[model samples]
Target: MAQDFIAPSILSADFARLGEEVDQVLAAGADIVHFDVMDNHYVPNLTIGPLICEALRKHGVTAPIDVHLMVKPVDRIVPDFAAAGASYITFHPEASEHIDRTLQLIHNEGCKAGLVFNPATPLSHLDYVMDKVDMILLMSVNPGFGGQSFIPSALDKLREARARIDASGREIRLEIDGGVKADNIAEIKAAGADTFVSGSGIFGKGRAEDRNRYDTIIGEMRTALASVGR
Candidate 1:
């Protein structure tokens, strides 16, 4: 399994003060900034773009920005995100007309690349490109919005992805996104997700500037992860 990483999704953050939200989450010990980029055409919702990423970097957020691009025609935006200081950029394989070339483009711009598998998307997409990816993000809920319930089936998919990663013998992160919370984080971890993405789960009933609120929520997640012995 990959090393444990807690990536708080900023989708649920108060976008009016996005940079501060990123800062507070990291300060509370989140391992990565799980950015959700949704193009209305691809997922029925329009969201932050590369400029927001650039703004975060400009605001001094040096922690890894895990960019999840839920956009169609993904290739065009790869360079902009890479230039914006995205540490890891992953996109839906189906969105890219040429998946390999898109992955190569991200690497060419100095960013780690990966593929995101939606709830029903097949694993066959990984057959030829396994080695080319640094991470495999498994969405537990259909992408587009945050605060959705996790699909029980995703656990099985995480197990399958873990098996594939083990067989490859390459260091690849197995990330689980959507509806991850302290109550089920251990189960998710046990299912083989080393990187956990939580939106409402971490920002529960709190204002973005409340660092203590972030602290308490994140601490509970840490405790949950620790209990799983991962």
Candidate 2:
């Protein structure tokens, strides 16, 4: 399995002070910055684009930026994100007219490529492109929104995706996004998720009052993850 990662999604962060929020979370031990790029057409919500990603780079955030594109016609925007300093770019397979080509496009632009599977989306999308992807993101809740409860069935999907990764003997990351909190991170890890994405779970209330607010939650999450194999 790849090293466990805690990617704090910026969707739930206070956008007015996003740079500080990201800096604080990373200092609190977050492994990656999960950038949720939602297009109103594809996911019913509009979110930040590559410009924000470029701004973060300018803001001096050096941690890996995991850009999750919840947008249709994903191919056209691949180069923009790569140029914007995205370390990894993941898109839903259904959004791309040419999944394989899109994956290649990301790599061509010098960024790692990944595919995301929504709660109901089948894993068959991985059948042909397993070798082409650097990561596999499984949405525990539906996309477009944050703070939704995790769907129990995602556990089974995680296990299935894990099996595929192990079988291929590839270093592909199995990432689970949405509703991942300190309380359930261990269960999710035990199910074979090496990368965890949390939005509201990490950026909960009390942030303004406590400069160290992220420390407690991130520490608790790490503590939970530490107990997974035991």
Candidate 3:
């Protein structure tokens, strides 16, 4: 299995102090920075673009930036993100007119390519491009928003995706985004999600009260994951 990763979504972090929040989270044990890019047309919300990603690099954050592009016409923006320092760029299959081409474009730009599947989106999208994807992200909640509960049906979906990854005999990572908390991470891991993305669960209101807030939650999450024994 690929190594487990705890990717903290910066969507729930303080945008005013984004650089510090990212730095602190990494110091607190986060593996990758989950950057959520939302465009109002594809998803109801509008969010940060590549400039913010570039800013982070300038801010001296060297950890991998996992860029989840929730934008329509994803192909045009692929290279921009790669230039902005994105280590991994994932997009929903439905958003791209040519899924295979988009995957190729991302690779051509020198970033790890990935395909994201929403709760209702089918895994059939992975049928032809399994070899091209470096990671597979499963969205447990609807896109465009943060702080939603984990959808119960996603567990079965995770198992199905895991089977496909193992069958392919490739090193593709299986990532789960949305509603991942220390409480449920073990169960999610058991279902075969190695990369966990949590927004509100990690950067919730409790952060303001505790100086080592991220450490407390991330440590608890790691402890919970340890119980699963890889």
Candidate 4:
């Protein structure tokens, strides 16, 4: 597997100055702007939604906003984000009652769609939706929060998904979200993930002075990738 740079999570960005924060991230060489959308029913927490995505676009964020929908009945909300200019929308397979319809709906809306599986969700859950997705996000920590510890158990599922994609010979990307930082990045990438999500690890607990912490983490993660010849 090849290594890829971090997709820094923007959930920790200061909402008061979102545009400037996003610009700062881009200046730091972030590959994607990760958005965490949580509906109270599905994830016990409520955060931003499609409206925020629109704001990000309106504020001139050119990097793709990779929207992670931690909401149920994804079909109802996907189109809104699509209209808001999301480049990708990923929903957990467990959240949508009709996974196929949800995946197709996202695709029909013109944004790349992906299926996410929680740490306890098995890889076989993707058997039916594999061909319908552009990417797969395997959560390395429990949803509903940021900066949780990485679950080592999740790595096996990532490898299994990679094997399935390889056996099918499909060009799909494997992504890992939560608990991602410099120390474990290379090992996780070696396990077959090329896309990564980092929230506190990127924005550093919302203090501007601590922004360098995120920068340093990203730099070291890239250095590890380079060392591994990825």
In model 3, residue pairs whose N, Cα or C atoms come closer than 3 Å (at least 3 residues apart or on different chains), thus clashing, are none
lDDT of each: 0.91, 0.93, 0.94, 0.83
Q: Once model 1 is optimally superposed onto the true structure by TM-score, how far is the C-alpha of residue 228 displaced, in angstroms?
A: 1.7
Worst 10 residues of 4 by lDDT: 205-214
Per-residue lDDT tens digits of candidate 1, residues 112-196?
Answer: 9999999999999999998799999999999999999999999999999999999999999999998899899999999889999
lDDT of 1: 0.91
lDDT of 2 by residue, 95-119 (tens): 9999999999999999999999999
Model 4 spans > 4 angstroms off: 1-3, 205-214
Residues 1-230 of candidate 4: C-alpha lDDT, one tens digit per residue: 54384787777777887778778777766888899999888898899988888998998888888999999877889989999999989999888888888889999999999988889887787778778988899999989988799999888887888788888787787899989877888888878888888887778733666653345656777887666543
Error of 1 at 205 (Å): 3.9
Residue pairs with colliding backbones in model 1 are: none
Query: TM-score, each model?
Result: 0.96, 0.97, 0.98, 0.93
Ranking by lDDT: 3, 2, 1, 4
In the predicted model 2, the residue pairs found to clash are none
In terms of lDDT, the best-performing candidate is 3
Least accurate 10 contiguous residues by lDDT in model 2: 204-213
RMSD of 2: 1.2
